[model samples]
Structures are given as C-alpha cells and as structure tokens.
Target: MSDQRSVTRSDLVAYCDAMLESSAFQDYCPNGLQVEGRNQVRRLITGVTASQALVDAAIEQGADMLLVHHGYFWKGEAAPLTGIKKKRLKALLENDISLLAYHLPLDVHAEVGNNVQLARLLGWQIRGGLEPANPRSVGLHGELETAQSGAEVAASLERALGRMPLHIAGNDRPIKRIAWCTGAAQGYIEKAIALGMDAFVTGEISEPTVHSARENRIHFFAAGHHATERYGVQALGERLAAHFGIEHRFVDIDNPV
Candidate 1:
C-alpha cells in the first residue's frame, strides 16, 4: 500500500514515471512535467492527445495537472515557439497547470493500452504483434472467439468506439483473425496483410490506404482516432485516482475524425 494524501509535484512525477516507464521510449518531447506548476497537486485531468481544445478544457475546469498521450516539442517540429505552440504553452504557463505526456508507453501497457482496452471491449483474444520484427510494435493481432462477417465486426467496433467505422471489405472474407493499431496507423495495412489478417482496424485513414486495402485483399476499417484513444487516458486517470486518492476527471472533446 502507498500513502495518497498531500502529494507534491515530485511525488506525482515519480508516480507517473514509474507507471509509464518514461525513460524507456525515445519520446519526441519530455515525458514527465513538460511545464512545471504549483508544488502540490490535488486534481488530475487526462485526455487522449494534447491539443489546443484539450488544454482549454483543462484550464476551464481548473485542473491542477493535465496528462496526455501527446505533448509539446515533438521531434521534426519547428523548435521556435512563435505560433500555435507558443499560444498553447503560454496558456498552460499562465494558468500554472502541469503538463505531462506519455506516448508509446501508454500504447503498450497491458492493462491501460489502447489496443488492449479495445480488445477487452470487443471480446477479442490477442495473439501477438502484427509486426513480428518489433517487440514494441503498437499494432496487435488477435481473433474473435467466434466467426463474424466484416460488416458485423464493423458494427461491434462502432458500438465500442461510439463512431461508425469506415469499412472497406476487400474479399468478402469471414473475419476471424484481426489486427488493430489505434490512431492514424492506416500505413500499417501492409503489416497486417503480411500477417494474414482477415481484417485491419485503425483510428484514421489515408488516401493510399484505400488502394492498399483493395490491392492487399484485407478488410480496412477507419475508426475515429480520438474516439479510439479515449480508453487509455481514462484507464490512466482511474489508475491515478486509485493510487493517489486525487480527484480525477476525463474530459472528452468529441472529435468526429
């Protein structure tokens, strides 16, 4: 057991660092405490990815800290803080709210990962990674307990994610083996195809993905990225609430994409 009352900023960082294993991933930005704030924290808010809308919502709700899957200062982005990035940071700094981000680590956690949670929701038994070469590969391959048509699986996905998935069935195949990677991983279609998956699911779609799906003869489903990513943040928030006895809220900004 651990004490949960009156924790300091350092304590919170240490807690998140341990939970997310921040040191392991080659993250684009600093994983923990990108922007410092008050020494003590009592309330925690979590969102899928750090966006302007999410930051605004956290500030409006008077959150002491905000945790996200995506944070500021990503690699390949302009180093200068002069545009939208500047405004976001300025708002966070002025409000004195701490920003913490965890990317790949959040996607791979057994209990709280996006793929794991999706599988739990859809009753899929996970087998292994879609990419055999990469252990940290976020895409997962699994099978339904029973057989289902491509349309039926799409309906299940829509119900679980609260958005009707964009379905592209290639070969009228009955789906049993499935591969999924949440959040704009349409590019992984080839990986899923190589794994001989009957269906592949991801958060967003690309123009080339349509062609890939047709050419490779694998069912491709584009569920909303924001919708798919909601679970991990909620799980992480619940974990924090249980661990630290703090007020935890998951603010959902409904994104249609």
Candidate 2:
C-alpha cells in the first residue's frame, strides 16, 4: 500500500538522482528535473514519454509533477523550442506541472529499470550485462529457464507486451540464451552477437539490423518501443511515491511505436 503522504519537489528529485545515480550517466538528455513547477509534489504522474497527451492527462489528474522515461531536449534534435515542443511545454508551464525525466539511468538501474522489469515480465533469468566490458551497459543478457523455439519466444513477447514482435530467425537453434534492451536499442544487436546470444530482443529495428542478425545467425525480435518501456517509469514512480508517502498514478499514452 502507498503511504499517502506528500513530499517536496526538491527532495523527490534529489532522492531519485541519488537512487538512480543520474549523475553517473552521460545521457543523451537531462536526467532529472527537466521542467520545474510546484515546490511541493503531492500527486505524481508517471508515463513512458513526456508527450502532449501525457501532459494533458497529468493536468486532468491534478498532477503536481510529471515523471517519465523519455523527456525532451535530446542530443541531435533542434534546440529551439517551437511547434509541438512549444505547445507541450506551454501546457505544463501554464498548469504548473513539474517534469522529471530519466533516460539511460532508468534503463540501467538495478531495480525498477526497464531492462530488469522486462526480464521479470518475461520470466527471463538475467546473467549479466550484454556488454560485459561495459559495467554500465543498458542491455542485459539472460536465459529463458528452458530453451524454446523462436516462435514460442515471439508469442511470449506478444502476450506480455500486447504487440506482436517482428521475429527474424537468424539461426536454426532453439533459443535459450538471449539479450534484450528496451526502446530503440537495435544498435546493440552487435553486442548481443558478440556475446554469442541465441537471440536478441529490442524495440524498433532498422534495415541494417535485419541484415546483421541474419548474417550473424542470431534470432532478433523487434518488440514495440513504447510497449517494452511502459514498465520502468511506472515501477520507479510507484517506488518513489511509496518512499515519500505520496499519491502516484501512471498515465499511459498509447503509442504503436
């Protein structure tokens, strides 16, 4: 049960940065406290992305702050805040809703992270990071307790994620060992290949990724990006709310990608 208490915005952000170790990551975007609003956060809303729909939902829910896995101000995007970005920021600013976002930090966290949560969801026993050389690797390698056919794994992913994964059968081997990174980490397929993983699962796939998996003879599953990542922010939000004794609600804005 939640504690049903309130916490100040500063304390909440500070605690999250400490718990998630946001400072440690050289993230593409800012990790914590993206947009500041109310001083005290009584009701917290969490979501996959800080999209306009999420902002509206947070406002409707009377959220003091909106916490999400994906936030604005990415590395290569246009810096100027105009068009949809401007509108979204305007809504949050007008409603006095704080925005907190976590990226790589949330994905690699020990607990309540996207990768860990996905493992739990799929009942995969984690072995270690996909890239053992990198201590802070975002993707993880693991095993399915029992080796199963590629189709079986695809079915499991579809059942859990509510989206049919695009399965690319690279080898004729029954899959036991696998690696997965949630949300647009197709580039890490090479890491999975290097680790000799039987299969690789991730959100979003590129044309090159298909060729890589086929040539490398490793099964690849392209699960929906939004679907694979829905859990981390919710888990983090619930824990944060419980720790601070505050009300927390997760608003999922449906996105096919």
Candidate 3:
C-alpha cells in the first residue's frame, strides 16, 4: 500500500513534457494534455489507447487522469468531433477527467519508451538505432545473447508478448542480430536488412513485407501492435505514482490487433 497524494494537472503535464521532450518530435498528434478535466489528480489510469472502452473503464475506476499512448486529433483526421470521437470526448468532459497522451516521445524515450521496454522484456542488447543518422529514430538494432533460429525467436516473442506473432520465414539460418520498432513499423524492415540484421520485428505487416523478407533473407515477425506497446505507458505510470505518491492503475482492454 502507498500513501495517497494528489498532483496538480499542470505539474503532471510539465513533468511528462520535460521528461519525454515532447516538443522535440514532430508527432502526428499533440503530445500532452489533449483534454483537461480536473486540476488535482489523485488516481491515474494508464492504457495503450484512449478508446471508448478505456474511457468508460477509467470513469468506472474514478480516475482523475487518463494517461495513454493513443489520443485524439491526428494530422489528417477530420476536425469535426462526430460519432465515436464525440462520444469519447463527451465522456471525459462530462466526468471531468483529464486526458494526457504521448506518442512518438513515448516510443523514443531512452529508458521508459516502448522500444527500449520491449528490448528489456525480450532480453536484447541494444546496439544502435535503425537510422543511425537520426537522433530521434524510433527503431533500434540489437543482438541476442546467443544465436537462435527464427522459430526460437518467434517462440520467445510469443512467450513475452502473450500472442503468437505472424512470422514471415526468410531463411533457415539462425538469428543473432535483430532490429525492432513497435507499432506499425513494418516499413522499416529495409533498414533492418541494410543493417545486416538476421531478424526484424514490428507491430504490423504490409503486403510487400513478406516479399522483402523472403528476398532479403531476413526473418520477419508481425507482433501485435497493442501487445508490443503495452509496457511504456505502464512504466511511465509507475514512475509517476512512485514520484508523486498518487494512485495508479493500468487498465488493459484486450485488442487482438
């Protein structure tokens, strides 16, 4: 049990913005404080996406703040708050719950980001970035502690992620070096191939990824985007709770994809 305490919304947003350097990345959506509700946050709920189910669950839990990876208002999405969007926004507003979102910043953070967290969970020694030139590259290249076959890698992913990945078998060779970027980064497989990685793992697979993996002789794994990205937000929530002595709960709404 932990002592109960409350943190102001402004302070929480400032801490996250500073820690994640939200302004550094040109993200698809705004980084922090999408919907403001309460000033004092005592109970916080963290999730992968700010979907309707998640919002309802947060409201049920009586959370003062809902912190998530996916938030509203994307670059090309319709500006009008209609249908599902309207309902979601309405729930938060009616309940007076603040919504905080961190997108690319949460993916690239050196310690608490999704990529590094996944690496830590799977026991991969991170070597460098997929795009070595880009300081804010979201993908990472690393090596396994020991060489293992493509099947072995898949099995490890299944064990760690709780979902079997869709494996595109490239070659029969063992996988020692690999690269990974979570959440729809299947396009970066080429970067992995160029980096001489034996295997590449990402959230979603495209039509051409199969051909590319087969032609390039590198194993490819399309792990579930939701499963792979569940860690960073939880890690951030834990950090916040420990730092501020506020109650934190991670509500996981199952999503197969």
lDDT of each: 0.86, 0.94, 0.96
Tens-place lDDT digits, model 2, residues 33-88: 99999998889999999989999999999999999999999999998989999999
Q: Write the per-residue lDDT of candidate 1 for residues 98-168, one digit (tens) a residue.
A: 99888778887778888888888889999998778877778899999998999999999988888899998
TM-score result, candidate 3: 0.98
Q: What is the lDDT of residue 160 in candidate 2?
A: 96
Against the true structure, whose lDDT is highest?
A: 3
Give per-residue lDDT, candidate 3, residue 166.
98
Listed in order, each prediction's TM-score against the native is: 0.93, 0.97, 0.98
What value does the lDDT take at residue 180 in candidate 1? 93
Alpha-carbon deviation at 63 in model 3, angstroms = 0.4
Deviation from native of the Cα of residue 51 in model 2, angstroms: 0.6
> Which pairs, if any, clash in model 2?
5-245
Off by over 4 Å in 1: 1-4
* TM-score, cand. 1: 0.93
Clashes per candidate (backbone, < 3 Å): 0, 1, 0
lDDT score for candidate 2 against the true structure: 0.94
- What ordering of candidates by TM-score runs from best to worst? 3, 2, 1
